[model samples]
Target chain A: MMDRMAVTTTTRVAELHELLARHETSPAAGNVPVHPELVELFPRGLRTGAVYSLHGSMSAALALLAGPSAAGSWCAVVGVPDLGIEAAADWGVWLDRIALIPRVPAGEWTSVVAALVEVSALVVAAPPEHISPGEVSRLLARLRTSGSTLVVLGNWPRAVATLTGQVTRWDGLYDGHGHLRGGSLRLEVTERQRTRYADLELPVRP
Target chain B: MISAAPIRVLLLWCPGWPVLAARLVQGIAADRALALTDRGVVVACSPAAQAEGVAVGLRVRQAQHRCPDLVVLPHDVAAETRAFEPVLRAIEEKIPDVHVVRPGLAAVKARGAGRFYGSEEAAAHALLTHLQRFTADELRLPVDLRMAVADGLFTAEHAAYSSSARQPLVVVPTGRSRDFLAGLPVSVACDRRLANLLQRMGIRTLGDLAKLPRAQVNSRFGAPGLRAHQLASGEDSPILRPRVVPPELGLHVAFDPPAAQIEQIVLRCEPAAEGFVQLLTRSALICTEIRVTVQLEPDALFERLWRHPWQFGKTEVLDRIRWQLEDLATEAVTTDDETLGASVLSVQVLPESVDNAEHHAQGLWGDRPDEKVEHALTTLQHRLGHESVLTSTVAGGRLLHERRVLRPWGDALPTLRERRLEQPWPGTVPGPSPATVFSSASQVQVLSADGAPITVDERGTVNERPTWLRTHEGQRRIEQWAGPWPIRQRWWRKVKQLNRFQLVDNHLTAWLLLSDGAVWFTEARYD
Candidate 1:
């Protein structure tokens, strides 16, 4: 009876260890992959059917997109003409799989965004200036039904989460001689009126 | 005894067909001097060009020098084949079993046609008359058509080449091809190396090569030489594989009263589109390229060629038609051509190229996981335009804006040349590249400590240290900055000289600044 109890206990312990490892590694249901350096802010990874409003850092937004894009999911950018492809590539986003919708007339902006939401696994759009609440709701409903994520470049009302990062100190620059190599960023994440802070490095990888 | 008989072939040859096709299709005047060049060498020249001493084997520059009015055109193989299709159709009316040797050359089994028309000469005459009438009626060209009947295709082709314009039909008597080919040079076998070798061996003519022992010749030169020797001896073997003519699968839809709206035409043509795809599927084929011709009322015809990366489906076909119709509508509005209020009378969809269905067949597990994504993107494209939905790739360029190449959905992705990308561009801004690259750089004022505008001198030295950056947004203090890397490019043509700088302001935003020796501009932003 003692031997049997010991075997059972060891087996139970192994099972519990495996479950813990999987919980830590695997993305939760309705969540997509996020960069390892960004996991502190997005603990459950980027949630599906949710809007993430990103401000102050386009590189951070591209970094967020790089995760799912590198994982071979189709991502799109709408109305952000200046979104640098080279930067997106440097941030680890697969340049070929990403679609860019640079310009859309104000009248057809929401419709175009909704159409992209239906197709892409994730869409990054800069919401136009004159978008109404109704249009936003309609787009959110489409996003919910399609189970795709949206990352807005600027302000988005009632977003599920908001990310703001500021460059604290740039590395490899001494005012004149050397180039701007990388930098440090003070990243802040706010969800449900609760805020979390993380200190990260730009270009998480060398 | 029957094995000793050589197969009879009737060959149709059109000299200078490339120039003739260019004239017929491109509407180049026949009286004008025209030469078709392939790889900088004149392959064919029209008679008018020949009158000015231009000929095949002449360099393009030499030909142009000889004939100052020479119109040089690159040889277009596809256009040549397209122009030859109607001629093949016209000949197929007389002989069903015709084999195309190339665009300008074709052959048919002379025995059947000869027996049907009572004699080889009668059959040749009959074909010549029919072709004459067909060319005059349809192409409206005085096509120099030559026909010859002889034992085997090689002898028949040589006979056709030898025939003059006056006597366009040359019929070599049966069993006499040996004598007919004896005087011809050994180069007629179309093997340049072997001909040269044979000439070096003092065998200059086909009769000289034929005089050698067959077994010795085979032992000397192997398979190709043996084949050439057989051609020289006029023992031509039967080897023509006649083309199995494909059935016409082009779809044609006609509106009785002419459809006004683009949507209405697309709606009415939905059944035809389905039928076209289904017909291709039934034949185990898929069309990759299609030529769409839209005929509008009041005698206006608009045609366009569309290509698909994959096989065209019904939905894709309908989308292409709708897009083309929308383009037509817009063009009508802009050009104010009589087509402004004209209705679409008919639309024809013809497959320009096709592939076997097995190449595109789905696997058991299914192919293309992004079919739904493609469908949705195509829907958006229809709502907006083809250029609105784009996929991008990083191309090799020093300029940030030039590095990104965007293509529409379903368009071929630009291939990245690794060697070019691996180039050491001296003055490009070092990565990590800025995230947002402005298409047009906005002007900025980089001010020194005393607020005077900073500048770079001709000796590549900064006039002052920049402390504040002023822009349309607002003025901000430059917390960190980098040097002005000079870029001098294209000095020979249009000189582009600029100095680039990287600056980080107090707001934690990074800016890529450029100056053309005078004013500063923000080229990109790391926002």
Candidate 2:
């Protein structure tokens, strides 16, 4: 029953997006750009005032934030205390403009995220373990009012889209003797609202 | 030619100030015999104590003998100075340009204030009335406050002291300062040693000192005598200059019911914070350092000085208030019953240091994005407690984790990192740096092709090449690998050593592996 409700809500959200798309302006004002390789997954890139859920890979979730961050938008990582700072920097996210709030007390999680959305262009957070659907909807409302995007690292009940990636192949190795370099990831993007799906192979840099 | 006479100055002298300040802090009655003792000797004594035969130079035991009921308190100069700050601030409230001659006394130019208040006499009365009300109401003590106006600070101070208890204020006419000083003893012009010498030289009164030839006085008593003789002749020294008072830029809010909730307190202070920022903005100034003082129930106070790399705005001010309140709340909840674990009575924000905002304006293109980012970060910090939001900067350290330091937003970035980054660090991990460093290293098993565990030798060399890696996540094939970089740290003491290796699995994910001769662990990942 919950799944069905989520699906209907997703469809309603998609219809809302389609209506918005018809009135959308040029790329400069509509959505933030992403890496070219992942363009097939998000053809028009990540939209402002939207939330995306990324599963199975922390690196990919951080990658989604790097593009907007590099474009001079301030980004914050909330509730991920163990996130690797070096990895975020390696992904081309500007470290100076990035704030890390590794922990938010259970009661203050909503307030903290709302505050971050007001000032930050992008907020990547790991939803707290026991957040209710109502809280998610309220946070989404806040994000919309502030015109900031939220990238959730785990399952979000009504996320606009969910992007999941699995490692597909390893490169830069010679008979298990050479230094470990980089690899490729098979990314599967599911747009919840439109019930659309896309797949692509994206390069992963170390 | 008469050198321009010292501008008329008013001195507010609190007699036996050290004792008064001590009594003010202790809440002791003025009628009680109290003496502030320094090094076991009385430095200052109250009037009631003085009448009981307690004098400044008397030993504590002797003073106790003279007045059995005398309260002997140790002289705390710092406490006296701290207690006197509010008194100076109070005087400054009415008279703008008051300068502290010392903790006990303050001087201000009376000429301008006199004209503004209609007359010098009226001005003195107004000042005395204000101080009297302040002492009786704010300090809740009956102190003998005296004020006097004259040509020079020294004479003015003396006049205040010499004035009878019935009429505490003495305002000498402009040209009568010379006449007022004529009959005063020479001890008023110089220290004890010089006063003794002047008495021996027959200069008993200031008039007698003024009678000596200037060059003779300079030669006999040196510079001190010349300065004294000039002062005795009613010539003003160059010391009394009116101080330039900085604008008072502090806003305060009182909670009617006294609030314990941090959010409620912050909300109440929001309007005042906005007004404060707007006030500074209108003056083209910005505050770099602010003092947030929280008054708790029953007189407990919590105050902290916060500094910012850039000028603070309303958001930053609110963040500081919330941070301070949160800290106070936590302290109250965790501490003993003796701590003041009560609601906040009031909050005061005082801008300690300010700079011209024009100097900090963004360049021609206007850095709007940076401003927005700062505002957002500051707002976030206010919402999630100050410690939750942080920016990482490099610092001096031998280890990777130690080298990276996190500072709260709006704080000055650590400068130690830049200098530390230049130093040669042997045994440091070679980069391309790891994409993600684990907060703590996780144990992993590196197995040979036959599934036997690979171990490092005493010389930091691996016994066999690992073909498989087993972690909490599960096992995977090792596709590429490098290094057994050896690092023996603190060899002289516990003699701990480690061998590090870079490993890549079939999925191309890289891990930094470490072995302490017995076991292997994954310390970081290159995602």
Q: Best candidate, lDDT-wise?
A: 1
Instruction: For each candidate, give its TM-score against the true structure.
Output: 0.70, 0.52
i-RMS of candidate 2: 14.1
Score chain A of each prediction against the true chain A by TM-score and list the results: 0.82, 0.76
User: What do the candidate models score in CA lDDT, each in turn?
Assistant: 0.82, 0.76
TM-score of chain B of each: 0.73, 0.49
lDDT of 1 at B361: 47
When superposed on Cα atoms, how far off is each prediction in RMSD?
11.7, 15.8
Q: Model 2 over residues B348-447: C-alpha lDDT tens digits?
A: 9999889765454532123223445666676666565577678875555445555556778777666655637678777666545554666666789999
What C-alpha lDDT, on a 0 to 100 scale, does residue B196 get in candidate 1?
Answer: 91
| Reference-based lDDT, residue B102, model 2 | 83
Candidate 1 regions with alpha-carbon error over 4 angstroms = A1-55, A90-92, A102-119, A127-206, B1-9, B23-33, B46-53, B69-71, B114-369, B380-388, B394-399, B407-432, B439-441, B454-465, B479-509, B514-520
